[model samples]
Target chain A: MNLYEYEAKRIFEAGGIPVPPAVRITKPEELAKVHFGYPLTLKCQVMSGGRGKAGGIKFAKDLEEGKALAKDLLQLVIKGSKTESLLVEPMVSIAKELYLAVTLDRERGCPIFIASAEGGIEIESSHNVLTEPIPFPYHPYVGRNLAAKLGLKGAVMAKVADLANKLYKVFESKDLDLAEINPLVITKGDDVLALDGKIIINDDSIGRQPAFKGWMEAHLVDMSPRERRAKMTDLNLVELDGNIGILCNGAGLTMATMDMVKAFGGQPGNFLDAGGGSDQKKTLAALELVNENPAVDVILLNILGGITACDEVAGALVEFMKKYPERQMVVRLRGNNQDVAEKMLAASGLKLYPDLEEAVKEAVSRSKNATKKPALAAKA
Target chain B: MILVDKHTKVVVQGATGKMGAAHTKRMLDYGTNIVAGVTPGKGGEKIHNVPVFDTVMEAVKTTGATCSVIFVPPYLALDAGYEALDAGISLLVLITEGIPPQDTAKLAAAVKAKGAKLIGPNCPGIITPGQSLIGILPGSIFKSGPVGMVSKSGTLTYEIALALTESGYGQSTCVGTGGDPIKGLDYQEVLSMFEHDPATEVIVMIGEIGGNAEEEAAAFIKKNVKKPVIGYIAGQTAPPGKRMGHAGAIISGGKGTAESKLEAFKANGVRVAMTPGEVAKQVAEAIKQPAKA
Candidate 1:
């Protein structure tokens, strides 16, 4: 899960990293009492990147300017995410910007620390970046090594190395998937300050890190209502702009189904994985989600039941199809009580294909036919 | 001939849980020689007539089991793995998913140090057609034949195996190496074993969007594996940064794309299949051709 910049900076501060003092304003009206002084930065709190280019960040020279910027930012919608809060902080005058981060290197099966002397906006494409693999216990000397590799020396090198060690400690202690400080700036006073921060807590480690539970809850408030509903039902649903809705039993299968849909010249409207071992309620919930979308001309259910039984899915579909007669559906059910599911679907006036290709082809053609007729009728 | 066969003795960890009991019963019914079970405090109990022990060491000592399949929760998976390793199990299969990558890193290092083979902490385990079933894969889909299979998905593996069996290309063995960022065994390791197995002829590898495991396997095949290999990668249309069901199925920073993995396979002379049915067709065609000199 991605943390807001304020949350990430809080963790950085707890890890002994230097950060500019900041206050969170949930409402534009709350900016009236702000006393952090002039020349402050107001940043909209959203989960997406490129906030600066999206006009989510602004500067204020006085209280009136700060309030005006806060009002505008709080009402801004950048990249489909609205700003729910604004981070107010004193602006820093930077002598230079440097990039520092630690992330899991899956290829090497270990964590790696990345640093670069050139930082800020273009740091992602910078050629001066250096990466160092860290093993268990995170050797103390590794930070100094990274500092030296970034072409640092003297007191600056010592301070950078010390800051790197502290960042590593926070990364390890918080069970983070990623801990990044983009533009770790060197101030005019020659002191280092983490200008911006990003932390991704590993989803599986959430149970162990109880302190992050509240933060995660707050993060959920930022998600779309449909996403939150899907979360409550334990379904993986990602909405898209297409005409066909896909429901599958596993993640790989769901994606493969989407690929097949696209291959057959049909656009997939959403990705909904009912998960293995889903019952009637979960299946109904998934169907309801897809049915609610008017853009979905057809719903395709591709289930390769291993732990999940075909009969359970068929039972749910039969009930759902009966209630929603206008909705078109094409199902391919196989494995684990396949005969029973086929019999049940047949009795419900529904056809179940044993072949996935045939089912996908049928769904795509049916969706095209259904969509074409409406346009022809309107023209006539 | 690879990791498990009909005569291999299997032990179950976390045997008292729902998944453990269900798959254990299925494995035993499929002719696997399940000798014992381990559930920490449930030592004196017997599940499906298989004796249970307090620890992996006790189970190993009492039953002389050489292999263990774990079904514990994710948080306890590392401990269960360590117990199985300390008890000297030569081959360990972890059926539990959601194990933290950090824990997997530690467990993998220890497994290497002990000179033992670890299959998966989030995998479906291994199956030798018509002989032994050590994981949670559906046993009815498999048939004894010449095709050797390895995949990173559980249900997708079943789907592919089913397609192959229906198309008359039965499998010698099928292994799901789990879908996590860090896994115990990789495609290269399993591919090498399939290369030397006498009963296996063609190989079918199912990969998805994540990591460089498939690329590494392609490199290994180009140099060492002489057998004709059919490859299929899922998630061709998956967007970047979204974990599509599996924790390890995300494409990050323009790497681990399905297009890249498939291209790597094609460059290495491996036949690439767009669908599972296509995979079966390619395998059948490869089997009909005579071995290259």
Candidate 2:
């Protein structure tokens, strides 16, 4: 749900906030058409933070230098997220940098703005910040008070407050989880411009946020193939580097399964939530996704049938496990229609374990045995 | 116990749906006095022998139902919640998941404005063991005891409750705050309720990583809660920024980390349990020794 800087700036611009003149380009060859003057700023459009410090951003003095920098920025990778596009901007001469962000504070039970005169990542350690809890029917005075609290006055204060208001309108209108205008710079020419920005759309609100109704799957970044496949299948999956594949009906159970795997001296290959109602096809798809990991020594399917019928999951297990008869599969089915599932699995010549601890213990040991050779885990 | 007890009349929203109808039968079979159900168009019908009404207002008015548990689809959860709240249902437990957080936020704000209490929109609802079963939880797994429970997860709550029942530790009430980012009630509020309830001798809070709810609960326990609060956080192995099944189970920006939550709980007066089994064991130890304030 994190938007790249280019996308965020687009929203910021529509919200009436001033952003430095910029042109977005996907290819280095497109840099020739951009009319931004010398000393251009080339920023990689990646979701990862600290891209600037990671050399994802560079300065270009001319068209020749811009092409070179554009090529480098587009090819750069920061924290495993590859750069696919670049935001080419004319580096503005600024007198000061300020930090301003609006985010939901779960502890406070409302959205609040965190503003500071000092901007950039250094604000993490800076203490000179003012936190203004957003009042309902947001007034201009709230932003003005915040600007004044930061020791601002006159036309500069008025402009900064206006920036805060516009930024907040975008935040509230978009149902954003976070809207940040980091380094809201005061230019040498007495203009306030957003040098950089970040916006994270709330995942749940994507359905209402018209711009991203189906945006997640379309612009998925830093996702493995299996992950993308799972997304397309409407399954919740997070791939892990482990030996045992874990599939469960709920997030809590899946995570607890992973924790128990670690506790029992085994590692879980992935965290997959097959969802509340797991029928035959969904179960089969989930099994296939979990089994996609070649290093996965064993697959454990845990279903506490609160909203799901165990028989469907059991049916899928019986069929999928039969295909790979040599592969190790463990299942713990309880709750609704569990008795039926138990009978179905019994008829298929598949064993079913009722106890979670017993099932997990057996699966861990079986996975350990599948590898055959145990190597010492090196301490980093 | 701050939960719907035996005498509380309850209505099931989306009563004609598969999940609602199923849980209604289960709850009725467990002896819960479900007064009525509301399914919009499915009026004058009966679900598990409970009268069905067209709307929440009519259901509340006709049956005198003061509490409602919803199983409607995620998108319509807000309207369902508002209907229940506007109809004078003081306690609204939403069983549906995947409602937009902004909608939940607005629902929560309205719930507060109306002076009503709301539970999960993505949760399993609430259960007062041996008293009332107004949720999707299997009634047999829980028993009447002194332990009170609050969780951010549905299945994990079931797993731990089963573990507790097997270990001879029955529960007073187990409430799911739902795993969504914005829920009606949280650990801090639920903890304070448990602390004041004489029936609830010990409180068990199951938290997920993502938000600062656990940290806030830790601070609350440090100051207000006197009961022994046992905490177990799921998703210890969850990587940063990856949503671990639950929307609220992600660790973002080094905050809401398992390590940070565990540390916060330990630094405060709360006893932390690493796993589900350990949580049950911790409650046993907590009961034996009077918790030090």
Could you give candidate 1's per-residue lDDT for residues A1-380 as a string of tens digits?
A: 88889989999999999999898998777776677688889999988888999999999998888888888899898877778789999999988899999988888877889888888765567788788998775787999999889887788888899999999899888988999999899888889899999999997888788897655555665455776678656788877788888999877778888988889898888888887778878888898888776678889999988888888998898888777776788988898888889888887778878889899999999888875223111111
What tens-digit string does per-residue lDDT give for candidate 2 at A218-245?
Answer: 5678789899889878899999998889
Q: Which residue pairs in candidate 1 have backbone atoms (N, alpha carbon, C) closer than 3 angstroms, thus clashing?
A: none
Please give the RMSD of candidate 1 to the true structure: 3.3
State the displacement of the C-alpha of residue B287, model 2, in Å, after optimal TM-score superposition.
Answer: 4.4
Model 1, span B162-207: residue lDDT tens: 8899998888889888888887888989999999999999999999
Query: DockQ of all candidates, in order?
Result: 0.66, 0.66
Off by over 4 Å in 1: A32-36, A214-224, A371-380, B290-293
TM-score of each: 0.93, 0.93
Quote the positional error of residue B117 for candidate 2 in Å. Answer: 1.2
Candidate 2: give the TM-score of chain A: 0.93
Candidate 1 scores a chain A TM-score of 0.89
> How many Å off is the CA of A334 in candidate 2?
1.4
